[model samples]
Target: MRLRIKREDLSAIERHSKQSFPLECCGLLVGRRTGTEFEVLEAVPAENVKRSPTLFEMDPQFVHAVLSRAESRGLTIVGFYHSHPGVGAYVSGKDAEFLKLWPGVAWLIISATRELIEERRAYVYEGDEIRELKIEVY
Candidate 1:
């Protein structure tokens, strides 16, 4: 299965990525599944620990509020997103391990550096394995 991200959603991700340069930024992917399609509803930025490479903590309050809003809008938390400063856009082993427990969600990774804002990539957790996802940003 594949996911389709609207243009506005891509814009939001880009904006957040630029705003949080030097430090990682995190957010939630709010959307609903229709038949085989996953339509993104919105991209909600969540608070993340500043300059912490070993840890990523999405603010509980922000998460709660976004989930609440998604529930009200008949949507759900489809996945999570984070940037990889200098590293390329690929799921790390740690990321695969973390996603093992939540196998149904998508993992979006963005790589931003001095040269360019790299393209985003998606992944899925199947058991302890991390599989690359085909993502189309529109």
Candidate 2:
């Protein structure tokens, strides 16, 4: 599968990830999906209710608002994103557990070190497996 995101949106993720250093940053990916391609038109950064270095939980109200707004703009909440401060852009066991709940939603993982974004990876869970998705910046 393919995930396409705007350059500005990618930069926004980097900036948010950097600013939330030491604490994982979480957000939603707003856009549309066509066949095998998921195109992200916006990055809706949400408050990390958990506010922990290793964990992140998006505020429920914030998620609802974003989802509602995206729908109004003819967009869908196709996926979610989060930062992994000081770690590799790979899914951890905890993330896997969360993935089970999201099923087909795309998971965007950003790795940052000391306020600088190092890498960005995307994945999708299917049939009890986590598979990486190709990213295309536009």
Per-residue alpha-carbon lDDT of model 2 for 1-138, expressed as tens digits? 999999999999999999999899999999998877889988989999999989999878888999899999998898999999999999999889888888888999999976577899999887788989999998
Q: TM-score each candidate.
A: 0.87, 0.94
After superposing candidate 1, which stretches have Cα over 4 Å from the reference? Answer: none
Candidate 1: tens digits of C-alpha lDDT, residues 21-84: 7677889999986654556778888778555643467877788898998999889988888887
CA RMSD of each candidate after superposition: 2.0, 1.1
RMSD of 2: 1.1
Which of the numbered candidates is closest to the native, going by highest lDDT?
2
lDDT of each: 0.77, 0.91
Residue 91, candidate 1: how far off, in angstroms?
Answer: 1.1
